[model samples]
Target chain A: MAADRNAGTEPVVDMQNVSIRYGTDPEVLSDIRLSLEKGSFHFLTGKSGAGKTSLLSMMYLALKPSSGTVTVFGTNIGFASRDAMALMRRRIGVVFQDFRLLEHLSAYDNVAVPLKVRGMKESEIEKRVRELLRWVELESSMNKICSTLSGGEKQRVAIARAVINRPEILLADEPTGNVDDDIAQKLMKLFVEMNRLGTTVVIATHSQELINQYNYPRIHLENKSLKVFPALRRLSNAE
Target chain B: MQNKIKLNHVSELPLKKDQANLFLEAVTAVMVFLFSIALAGYMLVDSMAKNWQNGISGTLTVQIMPLPGDTDSQEKSLRLNKVITFFENQPAVESVILISETQKERLMSPWLGQDVDISALPLPELLDVHLKQGADFDYEKAAQALKEIAPFASIDNHNVWLHRLLDLASSIQTLALSVLWMVLAVGVFSIFYAVCTSLGIHGQIIEILHIMGAKDDYIARQYARRGFLIGLISGAIGTAAALSAFWWLHHSAVYLSAGLLGSLDISSGGWLLLLSLPLWAALLSTATSYWAVRRTLRKIM
Candidate 1:
């Protein structure tokens, strides 16, 4: 496996001279270079329409760069086959800004999707999914359809699904956008707990307060370019 | 709760109750119905032709006209007896039966009204000569000998008319088979269109699945299963409808022809083949759906 071939020596994600655009439209992101080491956590900060989602999409193997290379888990996204990209995606989890839960499904089923897609045994899936849903304090609402759930509840389900597989990298876009401050802090703690367990995390958000509350480095998108800001506070062991 | 989980595992895509799927099922049923009828027609014609060829090939008809200006009934009887004796003496002739007046009347009733008195009309004497199964009789020599013995007698080989009938039957079978092929092509195209439409309708779920690391085969299997079920159900309905129509037609034909069309019966094996059409339809549907899904997914990110 290419992943095994470059294990421990390569960054989890490495992008060099990457540019992306849709059709004849002007490039949304231009000449970007970024690398994310394993077990690291960072915040992606940018104004609206600044291509933050576009960059995260490149990392998650959802979009190929218009030019240059995006190498994820040691496989270049440009050269990887569709099956290979799927396997690569297995090691990454994503939380879209809209939650993107399968609304027709129950919260339990939505959270169980990642494991089901992986073809895990039902018993194993049930155990893991129930445990995670309980941790997110959604055990009671697990059987309710996601369409009926409040925004915060749906966000939790989405988070439960993303982390169900214990993916090596977790990317969130405005994950806390629809939650109260207390729920947002709890969600942050969940991401931090995942990071403490050696999972790399990247969060995209417009909340300056959330960014201020956490002391992680930031990948800020500006004027179709990228600039990385180092941690502003001393690091804690959990972070 | 456990049952719900198991059910959820059965299908990750929420593809049920789409108007497109209902349209597909209706279209599939109609196509299968047409195909089944065409196939049955082909099989029936093929069997009928075989029966006719077998029955007609081993027999010859000899007709003796009444002697001109001779009112002697004994002379007609004597000439028919001489021809019957001559056929009996031939190595290949099995049995020759003189046609009874009643039998001749029955044969003529279709052309001439039943009310007509056949005795009033001077009908020719007809003899049915059955030959040995593998007989290679010299038809020309027999005809020449009959002319010498009774100048008014002539032999009917039956092959000329039989060949014409077979040609007509063969043409019908070919037309039926062509219709069957056209129906199949239309069925495949309809299924392709339906699957593509479903894919478009469920595009968001599919993208979410792909982002969740679902393999193409994973999603394709669900669609295949759905296709198989729809095909099986619609195929059953179609084949059943066709079988009912065939039963009605067979009965109506037998009634109208007064048992003449009873020879068009399908053999047991043919019936079994007809019964298996639904399974074939289901398999075709499953394969088409799987292929269509895989091909479409390849174009996605």
Candidate 2:
């Protein structure tokens, strides 16, 4: 992997003093200033009530900041219309914590949904979906409904669906939380490979061991502030 | 730019699964078609019956009773000629056509035996009279004038039976119209309920598709296309069933009306009316589905 550089250059996401609240309650995310440069890999770590999902949702254009500026792909996202937001969302892949696969559709159909929404032809869509399913090792389970899949299989399918369209920004929220250690490590390696292909990847999880083991740049949220662990980087480099 | 999106979405519609639901839809469509045919037939036949009765009412029959003195044929002839002339001069009369002996004999042949010689038997002179447009026939005045010409002459106006038949025909027609309206309302209600059930079952599927970047139009298209397919099927099935029923009724009615003048032969115009039932059913199903889908989507938003 390339050495860490200034996040301001070609930043894929830029947030300035962002605060989010749901209907005038206590602020969940407060005064959060963050930037992730193009093709960078970052891990978001926080407690269960630390609003990690809220922050990832904002990155994927699913929520709006209550007070602050949000810029994605150089566009002022805070004022973007719904249509514009929907169009922008197609370029961002999100792996929801719950593995939000449609239960009615098969694994293959679920993966092809994003591409189908973009009006891709059947031949191209089939080739792309088949390739992605094979990548996730769900090729044999293509005909099975999402409900029939195991936790690890479901998570892999969700990840495959999120990245099938080759999104510029990939957001995974507790993507491997429900999987075994072996599967989790395999999924982490898959994310690493994806990050190397010039696709910015952001994983939000509570697992410090996974973050420390990988030694990627980490952003920690505590007391309504974002902190980057520069010492963890040195530890990984020395080792 | 927005129109381009709308047009493109409309043109490249997705192909839905060919399942058993489609078969049920076709059957429903055909039933509707049959219902339409019956309604149209009733309306057309009822209208024709009214027109025929109206024409019959406007005509009057004059019967000259046979003279007791058979040898006084010249006097009877002179009296009938004078009575005809007097009626022609009357402002209420348009024109009078005196029935010749031969024509009267032909009219009586159906009721009486054909072998009977009309010349030997004493027969009354019958004259057909038509009233002028915008002129009311003064029955009292015309009767008084006819009595002066021949004391035995009697004027008969066919309004009593004509009025009664007209009332019967009008009542039948109104009843048919009421039945048709009932069928329409029932059809709409049934479709509405069915569509609501369909939407309820597919609610989660729709929401999932929406979150997966599908547009509202795309989701609505899936439902509308399904509805239209069902409508087509129902229309055909309903029509076929209605036709078969109508044919059976017509055959039975003809058999029952052996001595009656009118049978159950509906006119071409009436048949055209019956054919409209299928189309109506199809349209009702489609509209109901559209409304159901739209209403459900609104709740989600």
Candidate 3:
């Protein structure tokens, strides 16, 4: 693994007085200030339509803040050119809740997209993609079209794609939502392993059970505002 | 486990066998066909105009008519010799040849009956006057000189009728070229519309690719490739159709009046240009699609 050129004292993601709104609609999120240090793990928890996806979108450089600044990897995203934004996005991996995979392509091809987008040679892409798919227990279904795959299979494929690049910042939206407990734990372990390797991990989920099992801070969204809760086990241990 | 994967089967954007693209290909084929035909027509007319100009310019025709009620052949022969001698003495005249009786009879047979005795009629004596290339000859002065030698003699410079024919050919060439340009414009617009529609159709997939760190060029390249293939295949079809039409026209032209229509033959260089239309079409389509995709993607995240 190569060292992240952006690794430094600056937080991996820094949001200041950020607000987001759709066209002609009220703000989905407002006046948010947050920062995540490098190599940190956090769970984003919110009710339906609480703008969890929007926050992830901003961090992933998909959506610009309606007001204020969103600085990802130490660069203010509002000022980034489209090409620059694309480069920044390459360092950040995202798993959408809907599992945005190219349905017409095979699972192998879906996992290979990030590497292919980076212009990696096909041989290296094949080795990396196959290894990741095997780790996700999708080797048997590697050649199956994504549209024909079950929801849990699609979820695993999406996770494989997100982690294939070993992104500097990994944002997973309900990554384990469709998987069973065993696979969900496996997926969580994968994220934990990535974090241990210096990848910042952010998981957006409604699964409080999974949250309770993991020793990470929680950013809870309610009424378009956010509150941070320290890890319960860590708080108890401190007490 | 299969050790080899055919990566060509994989596309980040699923754009294969799209119905909209099929329609676009059909439209492109039709446009290319029209463009090829118009281009070939323009080339043909241009070639004909050049040939006619080369054959007609710098030459004059002199016709000595029979004297009124003069049945004496000696008198007519004297007048003919006088006009021929006058042209032969001019410095600009390269050579003057009296039209053969057989050739005159053949020329008149087209208008008169084939068996009619041309000698019995008061047919004018014709002479072909060839002038030296680049010679500065005054047509009015030459005609005036010829009239003085024989009162009934007239010099046909062939410029007035030739100019009218050349003008008509030039207008047709311009019209054909204009049609070709219009076809190309329509081709570009059709490709643009197809690419824009594809972008809209694949909007979600495009956003997903973007979120996955794909650049505008990355996605635009896929469309460009598709556009290029469509243009190439469609252009080939259209060019083939146009070539067939030209073949039929060439075949049919052989039976028509050869003197008026000329050879109807396109030169080797003209053929090469005609054959290159498909490549130009492909390039045009590629540029149009690439531009359309990039322009549309600029509005996206």
Question: Each prediction's Cα lDDT score?
Answer: 0.87, 0.72, 0.87
Tens digit of per-residue lDDT, candidate 1, span B1-301: 4323433454767667776789878988898889989988998889888888877888999998887676887876787789889999999999998899999988888779687789877788898999998989999999999899988889999888889989999999999999999999999988888889999999999999999999999999998998999899999999999999999988877755542432777889989988988899999999999999999889988
TM-score against native, each model = 0.93, 0.70, 0.94
Where model 2 places Cα greater than 4 Å from the true spot, the runs are A1-40, A49-86, A178-186, A216-231, A236-239, B1-38, B45-200, B248-280, B287-301
Q: Chain B TM-score in candidate 3, rounded to 2 decimals?
A: 0.92
- lDDT string for model 3 (A72-121, tens) is 88799988899999888899888889999889888999998888888898
| Tens-digit lDDT string for candidate 3 (B187-240) | 888888888888888998898888778999999999988888888998899999
Highest-lDDT candidate: 1
Candidate 3 wrong stretches, greater than 4 Å: A1-9, A234-239, B1-9, B68-70, B109-117
DockQ of each: 0.54, 0.16, 0.59
Pairwise DockQ winner, candidates 1 and 2: 1
- In candidate 3, list every pair of residues with a backbone clash: none
What lDDT score goes with residue B120 in model 1? Answer: 72
- Going through the candidates in order, the fraction of native interface contacts each one reproduces equals 0.61, 0.16, 0.55
Q: Give the TM-score of candidate 2.
A: 0.70
Report how far residue A207 has shifted in candidate 1, in Å.
1.2
